[model samples]
Target: MKVNWFRRQHPLQNGDQLRCHALAKSPIPAHCLELFQKSYPAPNSPLSELKCVVLDFETSGLDPKQDEILSVGMVDIHYPVMSLASAQHYYVQSEQVIHSKTAVINHIVPETLIGGISRHQLIERLVVSLSGKVVIAHGAEIEKHFLRHLLQLDASLPLPLIFLDTLRLERSLMKYRGVMYPDLRLTHVRQQKGLPPYLAHNAFADVVATGELFLALVEEICADKPPLLGPLVLRSL
Candidate 1:
């Protein structure tokens, strides 16, 4: 993502300069900038060296503004080292309605929210895990909008997020390769790639499935060259 690396001898720099230089290029929010100011990783860090986190959310509806996120699930992968055992799942408590249509998709019973964490607390935990990591999701927009809406409650909330969307990535790769598929749904793409089928709608299962799919697809895009996460995001664009 940094082109000047080849121009100079790569002058030695401090961490703040590296993070600020990268943050300046991207439209990161002020809240995010504050949280990552002291610890943001180098923007040019290669994918093989970055910490990756795959995220999935089961929501009451598709609209982030209208509906609510019922649960969140995520797994961490440090390139060649995947930490499946370090996965985290959280169910959010809400006073809002959960229609039967929503239940059918997410399988989240209203009873599950009896002692679930408050939306406030859930976002707190989420941001902590997401800090200084490359977050990934199957359909990035949903996650993006939801987090923005939830975390924008006040100036104290930091919703610094950009996800590598496997769904978008698959579409780009297919177009680049001159291949067409019936659909871009998670299950459909997984099937086309010879990946195992997974039960849809469970937050944990969806993220686990997405992580595997991303690893498989990235192999094609990177080929023999070492992949840089920032550049890969651009390739999808």
Candidate 2:
């Protein structure tokens, strides 16, 4: 029989809060979802022991207040290992539409960009995927701000997320070693560490790069066996 690597071993999670998929469209207050906290690994758990969801977003613009989250891409991580079995990509439905300038970077053509799910629906799906996992991203603050801003707009979009940022980690390591550069783009950073080049812009691909970069960083930080995850967390900016 084949194995389902990403399958949730515990179909009945202990004290798991209401399933995001089962919830109605109506908004739920943050306090109401407190019991579901355990769905994700504890903030202090070992990085190698926690399951993570690598995340990347392509937006209509850079500013969260003005720009829209054009797309979201993610892949699940089994602790220190990466897996593509559970990868996902979704383009958000919007009235603003994709601009030519941004399109050049994200490679989401006009035709393929059509037919998107509502933000609420996307959040529902994201919540279900992320309920019990850590989040990995190149620059986590971007995703965090955008998601939090969306949550503020729609309370039902609640997700308690902890992020592992590859770019930030690399920069810190470089700085500690007294290195500096003009740019620290994802592909650039990955190449600096001898990782093979990959096409940029696509959210899924970016997440994959970020995931791989994270593993490489862990190899450096942990050496053989790193301590608990609490110490590695990057504080909210």
Candidate 3:
């Protein structure tokens, strides 16, 4: 689960893609298999030609191994454009008690989560939505870790994911600009980018903020020429 964030990674080569393709024939759920059957974008594909989902997760804690996800929110984005109509948010029901400190931050209480959907249902819907799309997140590690743990795909199987992380990209840009230290928090970055702030902590609001920040960053990253998916991709899971 420890991934290198200092440098951008390239898209997976054909061998990894072939492994994922082979996994599609394994005894997995139909929804996941459907996603696997869809081809990942070619490495040289233009950024605008790719489909992406901006996602955020609210959890009991940072450790996916020990923590439980409380809610998930996502919006579809095609480079500079984000689709509000495609936004989806879901609260997850769990056996864990919601601590007061965590509740204060995420604004979710035990009573609220009581009406949330089961994790299995949430993941199923998510898998269907994620078919053939990359995922965008401010800090992608949290989402990637939680998702991998939830899917419980065999460790031997290639995850076959490309997670584009705004936080990491922003940090790299700052470093290139000679700034030794920078604030990469979601709301702070949005503010720096002149994006209007939304109420924080809510999963849906955070996803929207991340989506906007992503578009702004893309504008900066591709200012000279249209970039390919390989460069914009920050990490693969």
Please give the lDDT score for candidate 3: 0.80
Q: List the residue pairs that clash in candidate 2.
A: 39-132
Model 2 TM-score? 0.78
Per-residue accuracy of model 1 over 1-237 as CA lDDT, tens digit each? 344653342221233444455556555555445445535444466888778899988898888778998999989998856688989988999888889888887888889778888986886777778876778898888888788787663433334444688988888888777877637899988998899889888989998999998888888778887877656666544
- Score each candidate by Cα lDDT: 0.75, 0.70, 0.80
Error of 1 at 22 (Å): 13
> Candidate 3 lDDT, tens digit per residue, 51-79?
89988999999988889999999999987
Model 2 misplaced regions, further than 4 Å: 1-36, 39-44, 153-159, 180-182, 234-237
Candidate 3: Cα lDDT at 41: 74
Error of 2 at 139 (Å): 1.1
Q: Rank the candidates by TM-score, best first.
A: 3, 1, 2
C-alpha positional error of residue 115 in candidate 1 after TM-score superposition, expressed in Å: 1.6
What are the runs in model 1 whose C-alpha is more than 4 Å off?
1-43, 153-159, 180-182
Candidate 2 deviation (Cα RMSD): 9.6
